[model samples]
Target: MNRKRTALSAAAAGTTAGVVGLVLIAAPAGADTTPPALPETTAESLVASVLTTDVPALSGTVAVSSDLGLPIPGLPTGDEAARIYTDGEGKARVSLIEGDGEKTLVADGATTWLWSSADKSVVKYTGGARDKAGEEQRLTDPAAAAREFVTAMGDESTLSVDGTARVADRPVYQLVVTPKPSERTLLREVRISVDSETRVPLRLEVLANGSAAPALSLGFTEFTPGAQDASLFTFTPPAGAKVTDGNAEVGKHEPTEQQKQDLLNAIKPKVVGSGWDTVYVGTVPADLLESEVTTEDKGGREGGKTTGLDLVKQFGQPVSGAFGTGTVITTKVGTALVTDDGQVAVGAVPQQVLVDALGQK
Candidate 1:
């Protein structure tokens, strides 16, 4: 999807991680059920596939849809689609579908390049490094999303194979992963749809605890398996495009421990309750709107950025919580509360739940 690039949005949705425990619950668009349903595998095998599956080279269109009940500016909210190609090695490309122009990522195993069509800017990273934006530098596929979902879990998370269905026109096994009793995450369950033939996760969705809707969803709207053209992995910056050395320019200087603490204290909200009813208590930057999220202060591009905060101001509506009055942003997935005093609480439940969670504090 057009992922929100700001830290507050990340804190609002990310920080928790999934496949961020997928919440969307929808029968596959063209779901199919046939005999020999998945050869009876266990959660252990599915988890194994997430870690060990050797995804084959392929090319297709991926569509990520969101209803975060929040306003995300610059970044598309409803659907962020892209055409991707991978070599099954370390080479890949994603040509984003944007109206202004195309945004592409190409990795040739040695150095990766990001060319933004809208900006006509190219950022290059050598020795296989990440961008200043702190996004994955290497070729990351949809299966990696499933892997992240599984990898984020501890041994306590419960796992099960719900049944069989068709995703992206292929027969697949639906695996349900639930957080353990002790895990304090707000997520209730994550569903991953794995290709029965290849064990590749074609779709993923996360839901908040006791919630009926998916907080997030990522899936391929189109599919084409097998090797793609070799040229797709190649990259050459357009003549005269502003190219920055992504890795070198990123960490111009390191931060002191106190600066690190300041950042932590800035966004790190305490968890007041656990499971689906869980609430987070923290302080959003009083300067969320006024400050600059430079790379130096936040370290990660996601942090210290003001674009996302502006979106929050643009889209977030006012609401009162137990912590007192503030703003609330409602998405198809969950709710976020930022009080007048800068106290922040967010969860998948209703505003009242956050109020109750604040009361516990």
Candidate 2:
């Protein structure tokens, strides 16, 4: 839900496409039963409904299954489940079950807490009324995820309602989105099941080219819309848990306009190409390029540490072109090129697409 963390995890694990794919290709799969018949609605009206629908107070369990075919150090693979709770206002809580522990996040008004049972660590963040950290967490929800994708995929995509099905016991209209013929992407099509009554999305599925089964899917197995208990959004760090102030120096000083722009420029990646084949070009911190990620008892590799550059080199193949030489990491739905000079070009496109992206000034 943290955009910065998502980007870092994607870069560290060579899952750029997987992370980005979650947003760009959000949808749902079909149910095995006979398709349900729902009142006819145009794709435009369905998309409009998702955009206008205000999320109600609810709690649900999300089942996530990903087959990116790429390994991210320190992360578990295969199917995983997460619990979500929201008060329909500005308060929310999410709990994710890890291998032997749990990670819980709660956002109560201006304060947000992230507790990790694995490390016995707690991080607290405080911001003003406009702070959207909690709202962004909604992206993990099927409804919110599908809403974002529908909003962004307009014009360049073809939208249609193929049929209807039941998701989470609620009848839903199946809205399908596919890239136009001009867009070159590894993905096939996205299927989203929107609730017929409330118009909220209930499930989403993404299929990659040449894959009959969904390459990635996230949807609610259970959903209840109502007022959540107030206690769910409140949090207090456990005794002896390490506490870190996520925004300790928030109001300590004001940055100059130039300084603010400079920082933004440094963090924002340069966009190359467009549509589903869009590439993001950015510079990795010099120190990070020399950094190493260590894992303990993971996949029979005990206490193994790999540097950033070494990581790409080990997982990628040597590649060179007009943009110069680099190592390219390829997966089922994406590719990433890490040049020797700490520059990275990542996208859901092919290796040559990455090369061409970098070739442009």
The best candidate by lDDT is 2
lDDT of each: 0.71, 0.81
- Which pairs clash in the backbone of model 2? 27-204, 27-205, 28-191, 28-204, 28-205
Instruction: Please identify model 1 stretches exceeding 4 Å from their true place.
Output: 1-36, 131-140, 153-158, 178-189, 207-215, 252-258, 266-268, 273-278, 289-322, 359-361
TM-scores of the models, in the given order?
Answer: 0.72, 0.78
lDDT of 1 by residue, 1-361 (tens): 4454575778766656644455323554553446235578887887787677787788877777765555454334777788878888868788886777988888877878889988889988787354433264222356877887577563657889888777778777888988776655556788898888777788888776555877677877776779888999889898979998887766565577899899788977688755454567787776764566443222334434454355455467877645677777766556777776667778756777777766765
Q: 1-361 in candidate 2: lDDT tens per residue?
A: 6999988887877776677768555654433578777889999999999889887898988887878778755333578788999887878898988889998989988789989999999978887622444543565688778887887778789999988888887788989999898887888888998888877788899888898888778888878888999999999998999998766544445577898887667655799977788999987777788987774564666677878788779888998887677899887778889989878999888788888888887
Question: Candidate 2 at 98: error in angstroms?
Answer: 2.0
